[model samples]
Target chain A: MHISPTPQDFLDQSLLLIQARPKTTRITTTYSTTSPSLRAKKTALWLAKKGKPTPPTTTTISPPTPTTAPTTPQQHTAHLTLKTYDPVSGTTIQFVTREIRDVGRLVGVLGRAARGMGGVKTQPDTVMSDAPVPTPTPTPTPNQAVLHVAEADVPRVGSPAPTAARIGTPGPGGEKQQQQHQQQAGGSGGAQGKGKKKKGKK
Target chain B: MHQQLLSNEEFFQKLGLLFATTTKQELGSVFLTQKRLTPYDQNPEKSDTKPQEDTLADLALAETPGPVLVRATNGASKQNRDTKKIKFSTLIEPDAVDAFYVRYAEVCKSGMTALKKKNRRRKNKKKASKATKTEGASA
Candidate 1:
């Protein structure tokens, strides 16, 4: 039941982040910072003749609502862009609009590559065999995250857990969740422990 | 009401017959495999003749099919049968282990060849294993 982050959350979170900012000069972590998907994309793009600098990778693509036109990635299309008041007072950090389609395409490609890795790519007929079983959904996402997002040199998978915003300590019951999680194991995994105890009692 | 009741009876009888036919079709391979492998049917009339004929040839072929397991009064006699139905499946035991491994290796080689086109890095695997990425190029 992990709900994806909606558009408004991005704006709200950005505002909150800006508000919390000190008058600190943000050292722009250049594209040089390690990120696999970004490097892979750049490498792949360069390999494909797309050239250097893959889309300035974003942790979130706030699904644009009807009103906002769009934001472009530094290299590709960025759906939602965030530029803060420059670290210095009175100056602004501005980024050119990026294309959404580019980011989406790369995300899709990387997701596919990450998904198909290992001996995990079952033949279509084999996949059909698992259709009757209720368990295959969770099997793919985590591996995708681990390989692409968490892997060293490219932390594309390090982007927030796609389900982090909704089923979290974010809503009204945030504290209650924190308490329950701490009392148990913490988080979605901990949430299952309660069911385990109930079943154990039964 | 009397006419409807008669129709219902006729319909149920037809449905039952249809079910029997479909079940045979669905489980036909499984039943044939069982018949060939299991000796519970010492009574020849109970077993189908086609499977018995194929079972011997099936065993002698490249892969041995499943054994017909029987509960004998004294002990069981298992004649290793060659098979066609479950050729891709059917685990190999110790007796046929070496032969199975050789066949399996060939199959693996063929599988690798088929995968070659889509396998981005297979040829590079040898070099990739010895590959080092200069460790800190960006640094």
Candidate 2:
């Protein structure tokens, strides 16, 4: 029999899959790009706002450093344009983020946007209506744990084959288990009754 | 217990479910786009030569969210461009998405695995060399 994984397994795998993939240097959204000059102006303004006062160094300047470090695109800060649909606003919002290393945060942001639109945000109480299934393991991780949490940020209606197989198998296996329980119950009851009769005879 | 790694099919299957759930809630269609930079022409002197953007792939999860609808020029057999405007929706046909996911995962996983293997080999080599050097010095 092929062992099927639970939903937890799928969630863990998804996290690993995203984490294992190399961090993207740039991710472009369907949203239009802002003008380069406009972007440069904004950056300049930001830098100017955060600039530290420095002493005049024209007279006391040191010689220029001989070595220039080569900087790669990865070394350069990554700018990502993330587009998310806000259900409450009924519009797609596009924003830029320099922190693109964590996939969990990315998904959480998107999930929040989706949920704001009244999207399903909870795992269904019952995955399979027909079967008597065990309670879903209470996810110990907090909602803020983002990557590991089992919050239905991305609520799914149906599962893939693994869960499907488990759901389907219980139908046949469940009947066999019931039969075994009935037989065991009958045997134990007969044995108890016989013991009681012998005690009465004694 | 052997860990169950998410296979390409399973990954896509989960993605498909997510797409469906998102769309069913009346969210806007989700899309996966692939683009490649067009190579600049060697002879820049010709003013008439125009650089073009090469769109390798453009697929959108339909509003109804079944199989993905593939664009005509999906970097495949270019000869049969006029095949009834064949819609490559994942709802109608899941195999295309499955195949694409498999190939994409293989390419990405191979790159990651190769890098890891190279690092391991280098570490082993360094340890071996250090051991030999220590032995020689001791002798």
Leading candidate by DockQ: 2
Give residue A29's lDDT in candidate 2 (0 to 100): 30
Point to the candidate with the largest lDDT.
Answer: 2
Distance from true position, residue A55, model 1, in Å?
A: 16
- DockQ values for all predictions? 0.01, 0.03
Candidate 2 all-Cα RMSD: 26.0
lDDT tens digits by residue: candidate 2, A1-202: 1111332333333222222221111111321223334555577777678894433435543322111112111111223344323221233334443332323344343332222121122345574776776889665665557755454455555844456556787698798999999999999999999999999999
lDDT of 2 by residue, B1-139 (tens): 2222344455455445433332232112223322111134475445223312111111111111122222111112357543212112222123244345344344322221111122434555666667677768888
State the lDDT of candidate 1 residue by residue for A143-199, as single tens digits.
Answer: 786775555444346576445544664776877777887866556676698789999
For each candidate in turn, the TM-score is 0.13, 0.22
Q: What local distance difference test score does each model get?
A: 0.31, 0.35
DockQ of 2: 0.03
The reply for model 2, stretches above 4 Å from the true place, is: A1-78, A86-202, B1-65, B69-92, B102-139
Report backbone clashes per prediction: 25, 7
lDDT of model 2, residue B54: 14
